[model samples]
Target: MQKTRLSASGAGLLALGLLAGLSAPAFAQEQAMDKLKSMRVSGIDPNLPLIPQTGKNADAIKENLKRVKMPAGFAIDLYAIVPDARHMAVAPSTNMLFVGTRKSSVWAVTNRNSGDAATEVKQFAPSLKFTQPNGVCWTKDGFLIVAEHNRILSFPAAEFFYEGADVAVSEVVPQGKLIPVEDESYNHGARVCRVGKDGMLYVALGQPFNVPPREKLKAFTEQGIGGIIRLDPFTGAKREVYASGIRNSVGIEFNPKNNDLWFTDNQTDGMGDEIPSGEINRATKKGQFFGYPYIQGKTRITEYGYDKDPVPANTTNPEVYTEAHAADLGLTFYTGDKFPAKYRGGIFSAQHGSWNRTTPIGARILFTSLKADGSADKTEVFADGWLDPKTRQYRGRPVDVANLPDGSILVSDDFAGAIYRITYTGI
Candidate 1:
């Protein structure tokens, strides 16, 4: 069951913000609707629900799988089961998928044929001590980069195929420095990192917490310690800030058409279940601030009460907003011809659902069509039903999404510890 309520104050604040920019009422209405569309709510039940233990009966696993929802012509099939998996990456050239687990190890899953099951699954790196492998990316040179808690590890793709009891091709390229956590707030820094089209490695270092003070923010922004940072993969030369004022951006990707970078950011918690929705923003230029701690979606609601210090009026707003606490994660653009023509350049984002809201939201994948100018026109649910509103329980939690070589979309569910492949077959 789903409940709907209107926050007139929120709407009024949005309308006022729009009016300050545009005089036309029609345009303001459109902008207001856009803002509303981005607001999401989840975790209506404040009490922490018990997560079913793994290795339960098949019936129990099947019951938990109910969180996933798919369209009519598409079917969801399990591609692999990885226990404690959080983030993953795939190499199209080698037909291999590398999954990063929370257990400080990386696993490589390979399929002999595209249509067949994964013929082999093995741990590629075992000596690595990771609090959690939060991000993984494959370079064009067949090197797999894994983002550990405070370091980056690289391994050759051929190490999996080399039959040996002990293969040692893994190398530590960069040892990450922990962004100082000001307060006792959560500071899990490992998010998304990828090699950009400019031949530079970009990593998103999330803020220390939901909202920090101005001094902390200044330190993070000026030093390129928070938000996104660009570095040389070989020399580790740090350069400009990709984007700033971001809370917790767990996923990032590059648009294939323009090579522009984009990310999904989870907003501050405890602001009801719908005030500050998660966001999707494009890194169009260096030092682009998305207005965190000061404003959310153009509204000035500072969690740390630092609004007295003037923030720039032109801080970039998100291209698209998701429901609050939806926990939007990995994002990708569909460049394959596997789906219909409409999905050609659209964006697919995985919503990891919510942990703090009273009403549950997210737990699905969403599609948004990007206009020629790189702004989203409209967003809609491509997949859903991950949470049972009646029971206030979840079947699965989607964490990431990727497109395969054959144009199919693959969604990774971190909660159920499985990856689902969705293929479209028109009637």
Candidate 2:
């Protein structure tokens, strides 16, 4: 049963940061309502044009999908046309998906028929303006939390009421408090978040630099920069650093079996093509550090005098290492039964490919099989052909991977501005 105090008559009175199974006192609930009332949209026009769902642009995306190659029994098709799609959150109780963008908009996509494609796609909360709202997550109790470049907001009951322009909203982390204004950067600022099984919100904050100077390390660690932080979803209280020494992590997920936190960190640049490797790290407990500036994926960072500094004794290295400059971004653990047995409890990660490699690689999806102890056993490419081998051009760069209700998976491509659903047919 749902643990919220929401009643049939007072459903609209839902407040912000309402983590599931946590009960608030009467005064606390009233205070939340008061705060919710003050969170109003300002300075943004509500009648902004919605993205075109069906057009010549969408047909171009569909044409590109025909070139994408997966396993023999699997097929991929266009699911929706979302501009600047960065990350996605699939609603648990509603047939809707909230997609975030690096621009000023979040999109609401409706799959009313449970068909192969979305029927309606529109801007969510047209009345508000978002700044690089690239991170989105949904709670089991019906709240949609959007983590922007420098702020975080929560919408209560956003799944059911997103069709309207106005939705009840509150601030999970107010603007300028996510990070200092001076520390915000155009690069490495895309935040990603997930709700943990313990009813806390875990957010990854990327440090904005190729390699941060040693003088900034103390301040960054104190502020949870270049690390993952967990906080109380209700009222944004009890904020604490969960993990440290991460360079710039854009993908994070909690393992379903043991609830261990796993993430993908993009390593430092300008270190040649094949030196420091991008990392897939696992944090089994809080306060764990993953060796960022001193070491990246078992390679000591010599640039910016990082190698001169002494490494911490408690620093934990990455569990799995991918090729350098592969730009591994989003990942998810497959817990569904529709796929073959080999993929049941493994992980699917998207490598956005490289930017300035001598020869480009990794515009595809990769899978990692796990051992009984939850350690990574083997890693291999699961899908490719997104990058043309001869031309070295990317047809689509995959960003994030998500699961559909039917046990299939959805992959978001920002380059193609579309989401593709991949399903197994058992041939």
Candidate 3:
């Protein structure tokens, strides 16, 4: 074929068309940023560092590691240095570890080898401002979904796209609409999401009040605030209220053995440290309700329940009762093949040391074995010592737990802004 030589005017037109084509998405991204800026989204302020400082060096992690205690055959080590690392979702297909935060960004933590600490800690989407994009999950279809306080962003082929450049952003739930944009409150809006075995998205939304007023309860119950909301990942079109009456749940997971939904609910506060206990509940149905403002754990609320509406009849009580002020946050079932036979189907969770109690509590990890009927066998401390026993100071606070393919677990510490890996290596 003969080469066609173009005139200057023709070449100029071609270049202009090419430029417009390439700049389209960039222009859209810029427009989106401008809109968010104009709206003055509450939690997107970059100057605000949620935690004091992040990026802990090996020395600091080693010093803190001395204070962590695990089981007799288990060992813990620093897996990655992630800033403000809150909730983590591991993509086995890409070996990409995604860490969410309660501030402006989400981080991709990469470990070259299985046992080594992460060498590369890169921000996933640097373009759009993530306002408390605290909920992160890996969908079965190999997509990543981040549910934030006011928005939800999805990245397609996230692992591969980050190789050439950052992945293009796809809005899963539009900005300023994940919850009521006008009534947006930072109280308990930070969420933790997971792609259910049914190939749908699950997000836990905390109600944002000590107790929502009676008039607000009906709307909240209907909209799923203080509940688990299900979403269709493909279009974000199928959204439903899965559970209700959970006060402030920051962690949720499905039992690998039975696919039953289990979550950690932070019970009502101001009811004193010992009265209203925190919860580890198992929901067998879609519309299950866990007692919250009306009744905390199994006890009727003495402070607010008296002339108010009574506890809803079909409310589900927690399977295991964690102590009040424990602040149970994140959890994962042991599905890896590395641990002993007894732990194959057990649960491991983090307690993000309490702040409201007179004396400090939590700052430890809890374990619960599963019953044959999918109930709790027993609950005990799996890991502890993050809070100094003598000084009553927090060395580190664990926020969430994610298990690796090899059966080891990664626990995120938002207070220290780092991730710790736990493995079994003893007899």
Candidate 4:
């Protein structure tokens, strides 16, 4: 929809518009070079610091830890202090925690399994320069997969070789071509990746627009922008679109039971405080389209899905919706037995909070439960209080979450440049 009015708080919204820049252009002549030019855009540089970084002591973390609220028998503690931490993946075999960011490096959190905060944190592949390598996944075979702004890389036995510069990285998808150049823009370049049950790699490509311009729609559709694309992990061949019309999705997971896909989507902004809510969607089959630039949440984008053009008949609505502008980011299904019985098989999502609203919403962890039939039944706040309700100041912003092998959950906060572990000990 058209946003005719902009408020004072809209500055943050505008900043998001700028940071989210980085849409792919159509693959055509000079596209590769155009991709390079676009990558060097002033504000969206890989070297530029995206989040505030500072020293956080245990005393300070312990003080702020009092602010968090959770269910009985559940508690939260600082897990590790990871700078600019975003998406995370827990290695299946080694159980190492690999963190991704929108800057120049990736991180590994170690000594977490012991009864302590992480004793050590190190950068993965310190020798190689990374560019917004914000999407990460640990494969079933003890490998680490990373998706960058312009390419995808896989590191075999990443943990063992992470200490030295001799680490070998195999390029899964060559850089500068993941997103088309003709449609390239400035926003939404941080990708989230996962290996589905089918042994294919699925990566999220958020269309870089509040509402896509008409000229860009064709290219977005053709290049699989604003959708999830799957390819054979070994050959990077046999590519196909798994979902479409997603504005910008930063989190994705597969239900271990049915092997269906689930993702969290950030909704359109500047629509006031509560018009379009962020979403958690379930894709039961291939080629499903979750409406964007057309349908938003359960409501249609008034300006676009009318007149000659209309909302697609097959648009699938989100199974769950958070408060408007919650900026939901990463999510994982609770397959661990660490928590209470009720939490098993439920979905845990992180809401990155709102920037455009005068009254902020969602800088916390959320839970969505399913009925026996597997349809999403309800969504509720699981943990909160990161944002001070009194001063409206944020001490931290929850960006993404990864469930640990020990039954705890790792919550990443870019604002505070740290990660926190939440565990249940029983009252």
Best by lDDT: 2
Tell me the tens digit of each residue's lDDT in model 4 across 1-427.
Answer: 9778778689888877666563423232124334332432222222322222225465586678799999999989887778888988876665467899999889877764576467667776554568899999866676688998878888878776555434556767877778875555568888999998778899999887777877888888877889999987655788888899898999999988898899989888777888787889999999898878787776667655432467788989899977888899999899889899888999999998888899988799999888887889988899999899998888889988878778888899988778898999999
Tell me the deviation in Å of residue 291 in model 3. Answer: 1.7
In the range 221-286, model 1's lDDT, one tens digit per residue, is: 865555888766544566567788887788899987888888988877777878786789988878
Which prediction has more favorable TM-score, 2 or 4?
2
Q: Residues 1-427, candidate 2, lDDT per residue (tens digit)?
A: 8686668556644433353225444444444445444764433455656667788998988887888877778888889888777799999986779999888889998898888998778898766668899999976687899999998889988888776666788888887899999999998989999999998999999999888877899999998999999887657889999999999999999999999999999978888899688899999999898898899977889887778878879999788999999999999998778899999889999999999799997889999999999999999898887888888898899999998878899999888888888999887
Instruction: Report the candidate with higher TM-score, 2 versus 3.
Output: 2
Measured with C-alpha atoms, the lDDT of residue 227 in candidate 3 is 92
Local distance difference test, each candidate: 0.70, 0.86, 0.81, 0.80
Error of 1 at 424 (Å): 0.6
Candidate number with the higher TM-score (1 or 2)? 2
lDDT of 2: 0.86
- Among residues 3 or more apart in sequence or in different chains, the pairs in candidate 2 whose N, CA or C atoms overlap within 3 Å are none
Looking at model 3, the pairs that clash are: 353-363
Question: In candidate 4, how many Å is residue 203 off?
Answer: 0.4
Q: Report the lDDT tens digits of candidate 3 across residue range 284-349.
A: 879887877678776676654432767778878888888998899999998888988878889998
For each candidate, give its TM-score against the true structure.
0.80, 0.89, 0.86, 0.85
